[model samples]
Target chain A: MEVYHLYSGGKDSSLAAYILRKIGYEVKLVTINFGVLDSWKYAKETAEILGFPHEVVFLDREILEKAADMCIKDGHPTNAIQFIHEKALEEVAKLEGVERISDGTRRDDRVPLLDQRKTRSLEDRFNVQYIRPLLGLGYKTIRELTERLFIVEVKESEKLEKSDYEVELRHLLRERGIDPLTIFPKKHLQSRVIGWKKEKAHL
Target chain B: MEVYHLYSGGKDSSLAAYILRKIGYEVKLVTINFGVLDSWKYAKETAEILGFPHEVVFLDREILEKAADMCIKDGHPTNAIQFIHEKALEEVAKLEGVERISDGTRRDDRVPLLDQRKTRSLEDRFNVQYIRPLLGLGYKTIRELTERLFIVEVKESEKLEKSDYEVELRHLLRERGIDPLTIFPKKHLQSRVIGWKKEKAHL
Candidate 1:
């Protein structure tokens, strides 16, 4: 069966794709572009390096603004990001032949998490399965997997030119004269997969 | 500046050595041979492949017998394995110029665990540091590192002709008319580092 993987070109997403492919699944990389600048470039490059069939889906810019407003009202981005993730999953589930959806949500991930209730609701509503291959792993394991599988460039999320939905939301909030620090936490790490190498050497 | 590593020729130990080397430590691989068959061979071979200074310390057979007896009396090998491990550490600590000791005890490992109390006591007694480079890592990470770093041969602990201290203890127990099944759990997995290739890729 085919699995639609939500990939962001980050270490977690790349490793998640590697895992799905390793387990004998046909993986199609799906990147949701929220009309953000440079958001889709790294993911597209990563998909090419990994040699996976890839697609980019565009979401309305207003969705990101809505998410930012919700974060401002709630004083946290947890629920807002979760809502965006749910919408993305809903959109992807509608695609033909996408019987399953997967992401690289590890055990320690906080934001963009689809809660159990929402996960169940999505499964019931869409008749599609949701899989998180890296859920059993943690940050250390994910980093190690990335180190072994690819040549990645890691930096603080705030410093990266390539952006995710959260980054786009932060930009939108700033553009509206709102300081993103008032809504978002500080010091998160992300990576871009530049290339890969074959497994070699003992020790 | 110099660290003595407990080398078992398994994935964890090899990765521990790799981490130590990566961090600019002078690594010395110390293998304890408790007069068990094939206990030291793989370790010796791995040290050669990794091009590190190595030593095999001959432990008295009586130590294995005592550990096995303790397991039989306690109905579990946890304490017995801990005892042997402590002894191994004490012996390695006595080596000249060895200012630190390290192991490949990962976050998910249950067996051969050194509790906080024991760890503090060892440090206080030896006046040396103890490090577990893989302590923050889990099995998934270790396995991925091994797959990338070496060509390995994995088998069930029981089926492998190469033996560790625990295997020797089981054999000793069986010879004394005690079924190891009663004392040891089933389905333990271990691997031998048969060979290695130079790391060719950046990841």
Candidate 2:
């Protein structure tokens, strides 16, 4: 009945939230925060601009330090990554009576850990349906869509290996073992704004 | 002012076509078949049943054959997939005054070459808009949305990957993918029945 979107304050998550609303789903944005990060601020701002309620969950500091380690290019979704998402959704799903827990993970991601490993398993085990709206889309296309719609700020990536298709900077960097990238205030252009970037920080 | 659907006789495409029409677009269904493939017959049948003008184009082979390498996967679209899709749109783009090419490519593709690549490129290059009403939807959700409304029978996929997401189906497949996966056929299901088989080799 009700849907809760997994909001990360990055482009992918924000787009998922936006697209969910477009498709006529009653969506509530939930953010999983480690408590000590600027990413949470962006997530909060996104929820405000998009007109969705934001839920923040604090993760264990010890577990978070392992993010860089667990986020290895080849070994994503380490038990730690899956544990955090499932944990967050497990809590979110119970409160809102949400049947679906959605995310912004795109198709270009080769994070073996998330796609084929724990993320998939958690989806079935959590009894919470997971939806990735950007799964069939690439980075460039989303850039166009977001710009055309005039959505809030730039998409952040987490350092990633380069591929022909552009993934969100956050996801891209994350795969390469780093925190997500963030760009604020950004740019001004009419036609050429299809591909815009302000400043990317590896947080 | 007018938009048409790149219909593939599948559920998502059909639903997309119907939605665009409801939204007041002068919607039409276009299906492209490779040389002698019987994809045409089903497209015709589907168009007839659904009450739309179906246009069939035989490319013998379209682009993306070498780029994305079509034979690599069944339901999944690979890199350069968008290149081929735009090539299809290019042919369709040539239609007198058609300005927008809508497709059934949804939001949940494992690889998003089409929507992210082809769709965006065409919007800029051809200066025509590309619409995917199902851009943010996963297969299960699309199925639910289709059922909630009185939408008619459409194709899911041709025979290959058989993930049941595509709109084209091979005659050898007997059962409908929906009945087992979802609830239907109660009495209203009669109208949805489409037993399409090849009366000849060349469609």
Candidate closest to the true structure, highest DockQ: 2
lDDT of 1 by residue, A36-139 (tens): 66578778877887788988888877778788889889987887888788788899998876778888776567767765567667777887777676654445
How well does each candidate reproduce the native contacts, as fnat?
A: 0.00, 0.16
lDDT of 1 by residue, B1-203 (tens): 67898988877788777766653468888888787665677688777877778888878888888898799889999888888888888888777776688877765567687765676677668877777666544454456556777778888877764535677788888889998889877777778776664553212
Model 1 residue A181 CA deviation in Å = 22
Worst 10 residues of 2 chain B by lDDT: B164-173
Local distance difference test, candidate 1: 0.74
How do all models score by TM-score? 0.51, 0.54
Task: For candidate 2, write residues B1-203 as lDDT tens digits.
Answer: 36766765556676676656543357777877554346466666766766778777655342423432332333333344454555667777777787777777765554433634545666677766666666645566776666654344433323222111122212211132322112211222212323222231111
- How would you encode candidate 2's per-residue C-alpha lDDT over A81-195 as one tens digit per residue? 5545555656665554567877776655543114434544655666666666666555555666555454343222223111101122234345555544221112311111112
Q: Model 2: residues >4 Å from true position, as ranges?
A: A37-39, A68-96, A110-113, A116-120, A151-203, B1-5, B16-28, B33-54, B59-139, B153-203
lDDT of each: 0.74, 0.52
